[model samples]
Target: MAKRRRRYQNRHGNRNKTKYIVIGIVGLVIMITTLALTLLVKNQKITLKAPWTLEKSTRIKTPEETLRTYFSYIETKEYDKMYELINEESKQSVTSEDFIARNQKIYEGIEASNVQIQITQVDDSSELGAAISYDMTLQTAAGEISFPNQAVLTTTKEGNYQYLIAWEDALIFPNLTKTDRVKVSISQPERGAILDRNGNLLAGKGVASSVGIVPGKLNEDPTQDLNQLAELLKVSVESIEKKLSAKWVKDDSFVPIKTISKLTELEQTTRYTSDETLEKRARNDALLSIPGVMISDTQVRSYPLGKAASHLTGYIQQVTAEDLEKHPNEGYLETSVIGRSGMEALYEKELKGINGCEISIVNEEGKTKLVLASLATQDGKDIQLTIDASLQQALYESFAEDKSSSVAMNPYTGEVLALVSTPSFDSNDFVFGMSQELWDSLNEDERMPLYNRFRQKLVPGSSFKPIIAAVGLETGDINPEEDYGNAGLSWQKDASWGNYKVTTLHETSPANLENAIINSDNIYFAKTALKIGSEKLQSELDQLGFNTDIPFEIGLSKSQYANEGDISTEILLADSGYGQGQILVNPVHLAALYSGFANDGNVIKPYLLYQKQVQPQIWLANAFQMENANLIKSAMEQVVSSEHGTGHAAYREDIVLAGKTGTAEIKASKEDKSGTELGWFGIFTSDKEVDKPILLMNMVEDVKERGGSGYVVRKDKEILDQYFGTQQ
Candidate 1:
């Protein structure tokens, strides 16, 4: 019984020990589970086992990322996002609205485009802050701008963000400040003047009478006076009313109605009839008759030569959106004027001058804070032309009523003295803004007054005879003395010609080169072409600058031989010899060709730009033998000096004029009889006076019933008589 008691006590102790161990094991398991769960809830990942091997958290962005994102928002025009990417301290520097508005204004004003930014380098040396280096480029209106900049970033306590930018105006542009405002100042240079050889103002500054009405000085019941004023100024009543009702106009202010160009001395006699001039004067008197009608003189672009030199001087109009688009990066502005036609359009670059610009910082009161960059202004170059204004006016006046065109050149000096196309428009009217009625009249005119006849190619007619005769002599095709059987006015090649025959105006015997040319016998030259053939004649014409571009200040249509330089048949070749059958010559080119005759066989290129001194420029040196040119000139002299000659009407006693007359027929076929005639007279002074010598060529559209070339001869005579101071 004692042994049993001791074993039971030992068993009980062992059992107690096991119980304590079990309790301790269960408690240890619970503690470990709680620790694992707490770690999982805190980190949201199994990072407790290998914390160093795990990927870093992506919750907060780095300082470099914050800077890149801020610039990215700028590119997207998300200003609010950019503002949010900045720290609290930076936000205090500018309000959200102020930042957005400032950025928008600057970007839009400079027409910024193609924005680019690069994170050049990032010095992430400290945990609390970073210095990010960046480079940016912006294409602005002035030009492409590029700069390097630094943006400082700092650690932020803002939710879900680790870093933010320290905002400042310097981030917008290099060296930009809070008080400094970016500005672009443009300085417009003055437009150049167009002057003639004698310093006459062809297109330059002038004064116009500003017809305005003072509201206080206006007559009671101003309806009738306003209507009359509108009629006289060729403006609408509504336009006048609009000017009078301008916001800035006061009761005593001269509310300008319209500008009326004052008539020049030449315009008084030629631009209008006596009655019309009196009516214009009467309108001014009538304006004075109305109360409050004050005429104040104001400066404007003046055309002193008026209608006579309109084509030579051209005109100007306001710059358009299309013009600006077509010519990009070419210093153009909305307030500028562009050349519309003629010399003005041809030399736009030289006349417009370079505009000056300044990129600067300015205050609200326009006070300069800083000048970033500047460009000096360059004024336009003054252009002087070879045109003689007095001569141009006189020539235009002589044929003012006719559909005529004339070119007066100095053969000795190669100076184009005058270019006149009659029935012209006043360039001043364009400056003052042409009325609808006037514009319509100009367009509807049957004569095509707007057409540039001087630049046009016309049928040379008999005026081309001298050139053909010279070419014949040059190729040894015919001797000036050789007699080919006389056919008397009309002839044909052979039976192969069918009914087609060559016709002429005059009948003469012994169909030699001189007699044929003296009488302008078409059959004789047609025969001469058959003898010379197409190749030889074409070769000589090419040597004389045919089928080549005329090197004039203004562009000219090339003189052609045939349709694209093709003489398909003998008939066409024959027609070409007599200045017919697709043989078209530009008036300017023909004038240049004629220079050889008066210049001792040396054809000179016509020039319009006046230099310090007139330099004779040789175009076709020795186009023909000096002897051949003289022979033609000798016959031409007799044509005007002799009574029995064809051009006897132009016989001058003292001046000794020499020339050939031409009458070209425009026809579809040989059978067509109703075709119109182009009468021409090419003449030059025989006496060797270097300063006074002239090679003048004039043409009239129709002369069939008006005595053919004789009609042109009479007008030329009248003009020469006036030119040489021998009006008889």
Candidate 2:
């Protein structure tokens, strides 16, 4: 019985052991499942959180997100965050110091405002890494630059998952290695050429020799070499040093010291067979003998006619810091040259073309590895003007150093044939930089060489007689055929204006309309003004463009007919009729007025551009009736054709010239008892072959003799003879 009981107990014990093992297995399974579910929920792979829980969570970012964050840090210049994302292995290979140095070198001297970067897309084709495509834009002083690039990023395992930028020199820029760098090279465009009416070159580009220095390549101290060069070039040593100290100048930069147009103009003398040989030898000597000097061929602005067209063509000067500030983002550099005045300034944009550039990848040794991209520069457009070069030269020579101004125009079209302002300057001096002494001399000269006399105002004197005659005929105040008579050498308005008599140049008392114009009788026109009344005279002047600014390309001072609140008394009205008392005019204005009479009372707008066909603009379509215009023309013709005409000096039997002359007294001061006279003359001729009559006006300041008008009349004949080829 004992044996049987022991067997039963052993069997029970065995059963109990099996039950405990199963319970332990179930408990282990429950714990394992709960931990797995908690991990899944934390990673956002599953939503198993309690319903009452308010907190939200997210999974580890993908490779694309990692790359986006990295680029965001780069854009904001958060270098620390960017560095933290670099792979540990890459950090070990390249220290943070080395990485930062490489980046700084790539972006050296670039302003943050001038740089822009964009991440376009991430190509995650591989499980271990992804490729990032981006576009980078940089605005440099030279120009704008844009390029496409790429970077590589690799993944790593952390608490969940994260990414690390696969570090390589190429990651910064595609195909850029540790030993490679980027370089920018500039190519300047050729400036535009200025041409005359006949396609004659006025201002254009010419070759010049520029002496420069490569500071890094110098064999000796720059100070000694620069001193020797300065002595040879006749420049100050301090000037050379200052040029070398420019912001753009560097150890590897080519700093230009001076430029010379002609080899013969150099101070040093070296015998050679020809000019070409001499220039070659000089260039060689400058490059080889000087320790730091380098000779190069450069472009310069050339004025072919020099002083003859200085005032018209003006000059170009180097761009200043002020110019860059005023015109930000205009792509202007320190090396830029800009037009300072005249047509050059007016057409600067047209004359300055688009610049181009070359981007290259250079090695650590500064050797060009590859040409990344290139763009060719575009040349500026050429400008053609209406001025006849030969005619301009003739007019300039005719002045012969006299302080005078003149204008010759076609009446029907208002095409200015010759515009001359004497005592001109050499534009080339301004181009290369005029010396201080020379500039002071020019500025201090009493003749005012820089002043544009063609735009200046002067008293019209009796040259305005024809316009008054037109007013009389148009107003019906006087009959052209009737004899109004000179009245006398002097006349006054009753006794109230006693001792205020207006005198004339006439020696006779009785004068007809034709004779009054021929004699330029001031008394007759003064009396005629009284008949028409002062109010009508003012209205007539207003209709004739007085008290208005001349609409010209260049600035012009407004011409005046009367003071702002002038009293129109009999004495004042008398003076007004004779072209005195606040009656001021410019050559251009007078030319336009005279042109009206020649064009059947239509005033044409003057223009200087001839590249296209320009239609004539009529300032006044009908300034007077056709009969009245014809009557004035006939009377003016008699002023030259008539034997006793005051403008007899301008008489030409074969050409049939018509003109008027005046000698205006300009008071030295308001209190001065005596004053100097200004000479004036105007002439025109109608030729059948020419579509419009050619009109000319001359003005000479401070004429010594009261008979100065006669001198001007002779000059008018000479100019006409030269223009029309010696009329028989």
Candidate 3:
């Protein structure tokens, strides 16, 4: 009975212990549930997955987005951000300094600040990476450089998210490796050609040998190479040094010393071997033997007509620093040649085409690994001028040893057939480089060879009598048939002013408009001018395009007419009537003035560009009444056909030429009583059978020894005969 009771007590005690344990477990469960509820209310994220799965929850950057960011950093030059974005493997391979150095090499001679990068497209087809195509542009001294480019982006895992960009040299430029670099090569476009109306070549590109030195390839000191090249080429060593010392010339640049157009001429100047000997010796071998000296083919401006068209064609020269600064956005390169004057300058933009380039990947040895992209260069347009090459050549030769200027044009169309200013320079000399001695000679020449005499102003002398007659007839001051008694060889405002006599070359007792023009009667014209008064005479001159700028492609000096103030004095008015006062006119203006008479008082503007058909600008419509213009034309005809005509020497039986002659006295000073005279002759044909009536004006400066107006008239006859085929 005692053993049964003990077993029952032990059983009860075990049951109580088990119940206490169960209550503790229930309390712990309640606490855990309350904490979970608080966490849920706060919206805290709690992953119930593995650490690897947590990575999936974090944001992973897209390959395109990563590449866009990379490009932005590159464009902004944020090297820190760029470095951070680079893959760990790439960073380990290259240091920050190395990366910067590599970029510097890519734009060694360029202004990196002006570089622009734009991502044009992005393709993310691969699971691990993306391909980004872009365009890179750089503003250089040579011009704008634009090319298409491509890059690659890859993904990588970070702490909790996957980052993109497996950076490498190849990522900066597609197909470029860590060991490879990029090289840029520029190809210049062909400049336009200049042609004459006859389709004859005036100025064009010609192949020539350019002698230069590559400093990096030099086998000895630069001084030694310069000396050797100078001796071989028969040029001063200083010149070679000056060329190589240019600011833009780099160690790898090929510095040009000179260009040789005619090998025979070079041989003659150097007293060297002939072409046969040069060939036997091998031109390349001889040039290569001189340290850094090299010979390469280059384009040179060739003026086939030499000095015949120098003034019209002008010349081109290397662009200066001032040129670049003035035109920052014009894309002018330091190595470019620009037109300095004449038509070349007037049409520079049309003649200079777009320059192209090739962006390539190269090795350390300077070998091209791949051509990433290329742009084809565009050639410039060809320009054709209105000048008749044959007529121009003939007229230029006619000037011979004379220092003169002349203009021959079609009166009806205002097309300039010939515009010649004698003693012109050799344009070829300027193309290569004019020597200091030659330049000095031209500037010092007493004849003023450098002056464009055709565009310069000169006194019209008695040739202005026709304008005075027109003024008188138009103002009704005098009739074409009304006679103003010829006042002997001299006249004055009155007998009281006897010492201030106005002299004439003729002594006709009764001089009408025809008689005055035929004799070039200064006295007769002077009296007519007084009758018309200074106001009316000045108005007539204004209508004749005086004291106004002539609109032409090539610039012209304004022709001047005497102001009312200038003709205030009676003696001054008399002098001005015969173009002896402050009256000045250029050859072009004189031609246009006469052209009006031939076109029935409608003056046409002269032009030299044939491609652009410029409408005729009437300087003065109805400058003179039809009757007055006819009267002037008839009197001018008498000046050549009549027995007493001063320009009788210009009369052609077959051509029926009409003209005037003048002898203008040039005073040494305002107080001088007398000075040298300039002879002048202006002639035109009245034949309707001629396709284009030609008006020619010829002048001889300081004709003290060359005779007077008669001499100029005879010369005109010769020129006219040659031009019109009316030679006897």
lDDT of 1 at 122: 69
> What is the per-residue lDDT of model 1 for residues 1-728, given as tens digits with 9 covering 90 to 100?
99999999999999999999999999999999977864443333111111111134443456655655566554456677677777898788789999888877766666566666556666778888888776777666556777789999898765656888888888887677887688987888778888888898888789887888888887778898888888878899899898888899998898878778665556455744577677767777888788888887887778888889887778888789999998876778898888888878888888888888777767767788766556688888878888888889988887788787889988777788899887788888877778899999999999887877888788887788788888988999988887777786677889798888888877767777767767778888888888888899888988987888888887777888887656879988888778888888888888788778777888898998888876788988999899998888887787777775678888877777788888888877778888888888888887777337887888888778888889988888887777777766
Which numbered prediction scores highest in TM-score against the true structure?
1
User: Which candidate leads in lDDT?
Assistant: 1
Backbone clash numbers for all candidates listed: 1, 2, 1
**119: Cα error in model 2, Å:** 6.9
TM-score list, all predictions: 0.78, 0.73, 0.72
Q: lDDT values of the candidates?
A: 0.79, 0.74, 0.74
Candidate 2 residue pairs that clash: 485-511, 486-511
Model 2 off-target regions past 4 Å? 1-179, 206-237, 240-299, 365-373, 475-478, 507-510, 563-570, 612-614, 668-674, 691-693
Q: Candidate 1 vs candidate 3: which has greater TM-score?
A: 1
Local error of candidate 1 at 521, Å? 1.8
Query: Which run of 10 residues does model 1 get worst, by summed lDDT?
Result: 45-54
Compared with the true structure, what per-residue lDDT tens digits does model 2 show for residues 459-499? 88889888888887778888877767546677776889855
The TM-score ranking, best first, is 1, 2, 3
> Runs in model 1 with CA error above 4 Å?
1-167, 170-183, 213-229, 237-255, 263-274, 285-294, 358-360, 653-657, 668-673, 686-689, 726-728
